[model samples]
Target: MTKHEDQRLRIIDRRTLWNGFINLEQITLEQMMSDGSTARLVREVHDHGRAATILLFDPERQMVVLVRQLRLPVFLQGESGYLIEAPAGLLDGEAPEVAICREAMEETGYHIESALHLFDAYMSPGSITERTSFFLGRIDTSKKVAPGGGLAHEGEDIEVLEIPFEEAIAMIRTGEVCDAKTIMLLQWAMLNRAALSG
Candidate 1:
């Protein structure tokens, strides 16, 4: 094992609690404490695998391509279920770049030939094991090839929105853009606007 894997924690037991669309596992582990003592803990983990997301920017028009879709989780929280988000989806065994490009095309109708990888992040580290890869892809709205509303068979009824970059940023403050991956990509765009123009 690598040095990082040689940690003070040892798994005492691990069992699957639920095995549905998303797997839930119950873990029991022991951790060495600061005073050379050990502590036992039990925790549940949700595993849905990794995902990827991309922010499509039109530098010349100073606009961005986003999608709005119903999110049951958000609706359950007493907020609007329709969420504005960057084009994103699960990797599903594909590479991050390949997955994001496919998702972008399916969700935004913009065929992303190449995407600049930004970073990877864990949206909910406490209990979920979903690490999302983020990317930035330049696009031309006029060049859209398909009427992207997502794959009909997948039950995706996404609404494509092409908003000015500035206005999209404003939506963040207005609570219209609440998706974590989307927000991170927008913030990254804000910080790297100059580079994007090229």
Candidate 2:
């Protein structure tokens, strides 16, 4: 094994606990203690694959486009199922930029002119095996290629909202926009305001 692989944690075996649209894998593992002892543990990990999210910014209009859709799991927990988030989707083997652009068009009806890659993050590393690539893409009102509401087959009834950047940021403090990726990109945009305006 490589030097990095010689860690204190070792995987004895791993098996799929549930496999479907999303997969769950249960792992049997052991970790060397601080005092040189070993402890075995079992962990169940949910694999949703990698994803990409893009915040479509219309600098000329000083607005950002976001999507609100029903997220059943979130709804089941007693809160509203509808969530406001940046246009995002699983990579499906595509490059991060390509996937984000495609998702932007599909969910927001806006064709991105240029995309600036921001960063990648694991949204829920404790249980999920999904790392999402974040991006900022420029767009204009004229970039609307279609009346996008997401794919019908995918059961996505998305409501696209184009709100002023300032208001979008304010929504974060009001707890109106709670999606982590959206909050990250919005904060980044606020911090990079000068660059965004030509």
Candidate 3:
């Protein structure tokens, strides 16, 4: 058996709880503990499929392109519903590179020929089954090809923002930029600023 098989984990039961734009399911599982005892546990999982996000940077101008949109969850939690985030969207069966590129164009009007694949991460591993691919793409803000505010049919009213790199970092401290993915990419840019100019 493989190393994973040695753990002795089994699924007891699984049932769909909801099916809509996202899928929710209840799952019960059994696993062998470190003390050689078996334990059963039940949990709910949210599956929204895989997704991708990209940070668009203009090295010459030292600015970053971002988007702001309403998020019901944040509003329900008593905070501003609009969130400033890196351009991102569900892959929907497309390749990570292709999905991120399309999202950038549709949300920011920046035509990205290609992007550097930085990493992939599970934003919330405990319950959500979404794994997002992170990328960095250089952009020329002077070459905007379209007026991108997202699709009206999909109810997306996105506001595009261009902030200086230093100011963007300061916004993080002030909580103006609170999206986890955007924060991560901004921190990455800080750590790799030297390479970004090249």
Ranking by TM-score: 3, 1, 2
Q: What's the alpha carbon RMSD for model 1?
A: 1.3
Candidate 3 per-residue lDDT over residues 31-61, each given as its tens digit: 8898989999999999989999999999999
TM, every model: 0.96, 0.95, 0.96
Residue 44's lDDT within candidate 2 is 96
lDDT of 2 at 56: 86
Backbone clashes counted, model 3 = 0
Model 3 Cα shift for residue 185 (angstroms): 0.2
**lDDT over C-alpha atoms for residue 163 of model 2:** 91
Sort the candidates on lDDT, descending order: 3, 1, 2
Question: Between the candidate structures 1 and 2, which one is better when assessed by TM-score?
Answer: 1
TM-score of 1: 0.96
Cα lDDT of model 2 by residue, 52-154, tens digit: 9988888899999999999889899888989999999999999999888888889988888667888899999998989999888888866788898999999
- Candidate 2 wrong stretches, greater than 4 Å: 1-6
What is the Cα-based lDDT of residue 75 in candidate 2?
90
On lDDT, the leading prediction is 3
